[model samples]
Target: MSGGENSSRLIDVVLDESIGRSTPDVEHERAVAIFDLIEENAFHPVGDEGGGPYRLNLSLADSRLVLKVTREDGGDVVTHILSLTPFRRIVKDYFLICESYYQAIRSATPSQIEAIDMGRRGLHNEGSQTLMDRLSGKIEVDFDTARRLFTLVCVLHWRG
Candidate 1:
């Protein structure tokens, strides 16, 4: 397909309901910043096996992001951005998604990480399930990948 066709195809993927969760205009801006943060954070490749030249393509709306994981031979894995909730939530969700996908790719996957300590434990309860648990059946996310992501989370700061 041509660029125009691909562009149209991308446009068809609706943003996840997370964007609608933003309560205020300021929250909306924070969501955008979180998206940018995720985009920037995504530049680094994850896991040794499926080494990417991971490429990110932002969708039609600023609400979602598409990360295309590429191989040395030019093969690729296309991941659609499903959600971008308000404030700190998006940051949590994005990294969890990436880390979980990364971990799912591993030969040995960790069980799950849950949120405790009033969300201060740094564990992100993005959805009802851990990104690993959800993506585990779909992909393979191992320790190193998860660790890298956890580390990424430590460094990810939302700018107002």
Candidate 2:
């Protein structure tokens, strides 16, 4: 897959997790935030009319992430989440972060790329073969790397 495609896939997995078993603490407000935003089917004009279709409700202690779903032709629907790393571990009194990391095989910054380029060393691991195979050798995987990637798959498959 292309870089943008991979990035979006990663984001989807994270957002799917947030929709279901969302760290418990942040789930409630995140749900409520979505509710308020879509209080009516006629919900129109974003953010009190000044900005776009989204606005921060500071009194409500909001986050910029907006999760939306819509059905075209009243058929099967899908979720649309807007964020730059938007999902959080919790959104209780204060928003807590969801931590995720990746080691790129390419296009990573020069200084850091070399370290990851060497890949996970010390008899520890390499990347995942499944992804690599699917990518026609463009991607790679070692057992440890597959284990790391399982988190992404698990989150995407989770249901509330």
Candidate 3:
């Protein structure tokens, strides 16, 4: 469970209680992100916290993103509070592009949709990279894992 295996990944992930209602697509995106993240990810907490199989709870509070991690058995691990200020611009751009992508899918030509999707993926990658940079020294995760986590963060910010 130590070296390089999926054993160090998150076993469960939950959103805050007040997430309220979301569009079907939004809910689907959240579900897939969590499922894919837990299924295959490399997440190793820094310091003497010990290796995981961890559970993560994501929430937004007062313009901050709260990541509460716990052991598989529910023991406390670490709570990382990150100010959302740095992510504001990127998230906004991502959402706006995503909306365009979705709309393009409905009526635009194939090439148009593809172009919008490419832009969407680029923004998504940028957001993921920012997340990795922000989480550096606090938690370790691979690029794909960070991308999925970024999706969850966007979902959490949907109402804001």
lDDT of 2: 0.29
CA lDDT of each candidate?
0.38, 0.29, 0.84
Rank candidates by TM-score, best first.
3, 1, 2
| lDDT, candidate 1, 1-160, per-residue tens | 3332222111111223432333464455444544443333323333334444333332324643234444434455545343333324646555556455555556333443232222333444333234334334333434444333333232323222
- The number of the candidate with the highest TM-score is 3
What TM-score, to 2 decimals, does candidate 2 have?
Answer: 0.22
Off by over 4 Å in 3: 1-4, 23-25
TM-score of each: 0.33, 0.22, 0.88
Backbone clash tally (model 2): 9
Q: RMSD in Å for candidate 3, one decimal?
A: 2.3
Better of 2 and 3 by TM-score: 3
The TM-score between candidate 3 and the true structure equals: 0.88
Tens-digit lDDT track of model 2 for 1-160: 3342222111111233333455554555345434432332121122122212222221101222232322222221232222222123212101111111143323457757555434333111212233223323222233433334323332322232
Q: Quantify how close model 1 is to the true structure by its C-alpha RMSD in Å.
A: 14.4
